[model samples]
Target: MTSGDVSLETVTAAKAGDRKALEDVLAGLQDRIYSLAMRVLVNPDDAGEATQEILIQILTKLSTFRGESALSTWAYQIAVRHILNARKLRDRDLGLTFEMFATDLETGLVADPPAAPDQALLLNELRISCTMAMLLCLTLELRLAYVLGDVFEMDHAEASRILELTPAAYRKRLSRARAEVIAFTSQHCGLVSNQAKCSCPRRLPAALKSGRIRSGSYPNSAGASVDYAAAKQQIASVVDDLKTFKLQQAVPGQMCPEDIRGRLTRMLSHPL
Candidate 1:
């Protein structure tokens, strides 16, 4: 049968509460759902639990689906809600920022004469752990916005519909999510570090020279070398503008920590 025929069959069987059909549907979509969950939860254990919960929810709610949207869309919506609720239950501090999760997985990967076996193993584990952690820091709304837009490559309108947000609101959330990812990358991945000479705009050439960043290649769950040159440039421009503004407000000699904190708060409060 064609793909559509198969999907229809699965839907019918799923509605009829066929356990094998439910299992088939879950198996078919497991990787996509798992990857999205991992990206949002940033923790493999949490992602796995969320994935299981999502499958269970899909099975239970399959009959309620009224054909208002495609089966995939309905599945995505359920997964998104499951992940969001899981995050809420775990993290009481809504102020939890994304910076805490972005670790430098590429560290020591380019050591001289190649890394020793243990060092190599450690680096590999770090990459996997860091990617999982990064997914956990994102807010539910931002995570859904990113997964649908970036991973699925859905257009803004389509993403908005899946997310149940206005086009403008979806765009705004997407922008914020992108910014958070950029900032988290810069802070955690040593994307802007003086030690490796990998700071933002300058890191692209360095990363290529060291063979740390690959183009058009996808890495499995562990981590992939990303083309962050453009993202870095954009984020760097924002950082530079902020730095310039801060310098402009400086009164030369006396600086108070509280005053600096207040200024930083104000800067962050401003829209990008």
Candidate 2:
């Protein structure tokens, strides 16, 4: 859904008060909005609320579509704006910085953590949550740059447009983000560096103790195993400094709540 996945006919139909056509358009945007929100917000509850707000804006603003940009890009621009300017989530209230996060990572390490039969799944969940948390260490601007340019692999032109920045400015932001993230991971994450102290198994005990990940709270499928060795190999298999972003991107996106669709459907019954 890069430029214009939604057809002009559909956009026109949506703008003209066609309920079915509008749902079609909104459905296409839902997963993407939710995914972006999840990355930016980290907390599921926060991401879900932000997703709904962004979708409502898109729904109310559908008539403003001029077709100058891809519908996806236009909607993404809205999402990026909301994320950058939105109020902070509870998890973010900690004001996590790289230095503080580094210390936190070092605080809990179990040489022989408790073992579970579902060890693979536990590691996968930890990998997802831990990597997602890393993005919080960056400022909103830097995080968006890293997610769009580095994680999602969007072109500089498109990413810059979405971020409302010049290509050069976006590039510089991404470069700084890339360097900062890479330095942190390479120095503290065992997945990207042999010298790092944190490993999924080593941190699992602390994570559970701290309620970072609770029993029965794992997403349907957290993701494939991402032990330090396997994650390191996965990174080595990709281009440089993508280890963190690759892991971040691999976490399954939050599914848009079904009630959102129903709510929007009911809204269509009223005057816009």
Candidate 3:
């Protein structure tokens, strides 16, 4: 079915209490819903729970929907509110002050290495993940503005309506969010540069003269025999660890603070 037809059908079935139709609607929109939840919650587990809650809310409240907006938009509204509430609960449960999370993120970035020239692809993925994690710490108003405007590429007027804020208010929130993200990226870039300077081997020319440079068609003087598969596996592990860290942060209830700390310690002990 075309999107419009499917939407209309879902609405009709939803109004008639057809559970399968509701499921179909949710299944069709799961990616968008999950992406929004993940962007706001910054943890898979929390995002998963938030997704479930949002789906339930959509089903229960389907009858109340005035049809003033598209079903997708209305569902998005519900998802956004659910994420906001989940974040609040997570913060309260962990006894975490927003300042603490922000400080930790700042400190983590400082200690992180710069993007490797050869690892540019992996680094870009990490950068996107870091940006999403940062979004989790933003206020709901700002988070919605950023996700809708920046991530989803929504127009200011549309975002304003979704956020139920004046265009000026939305603009302010978008401005703040953009500024925060840019500042974070700038700091991160500095950290990466410093790390590369410190850790990267010095005197590639001298190394080549000494026959220490490996025979590789690739640049960066890496040996052709370099275990790219192993290296990739290691990077994947680190990404997984980071994902777990994000999940812990997003859903603290899933793991005790001590458990989270231990996991982080182990991850750090093993260098990326």
lDDT of each: 0.52, 0.80, 0.52
lDDT (Cα, 0-100) at 94 in candidate 3? 39
Clashing pairs in 2: 3-70
Clashes of each: 7, 1, 1
Per-model TM against the reference? 0.59, 0.90, 0.58
Q: After the best TM-score superposition of candidate 2, give how far the Cα of residue 119 lies from its true spot, in angstroms.
A: 1.3
What TM-score does prediction 1 earn?
Answer: 0.59
Q: Stretches of candidate 3 above 4 Å error?
A: 1-5, 86-125, 190-272
RMSD of 2: 2.6
Candidate with best lDDT = 2
Task: Give lDDT tens digits, candidate 3, residues 136-224.
Answer: 55666676787787777778876787777899998999888766654443333222233222111222323233443332322221222
lDDT of 2 by residue, 117-216 (tens): 7676667778778888888999888988988887778999999999999999999999999899988988887676667899878988888899887766
Candidates 1 and 3 compared by TM-score, better number: 1
Better of 2 and 3 by lDDT: 2
Q: What lDDT score is found at residue 160 in candidate 3? A: 82
All candidates in order of lDDT, best leading: 2, 3, 1
What would you estimate as the lDDT of candidate 3? Answer: 0.52
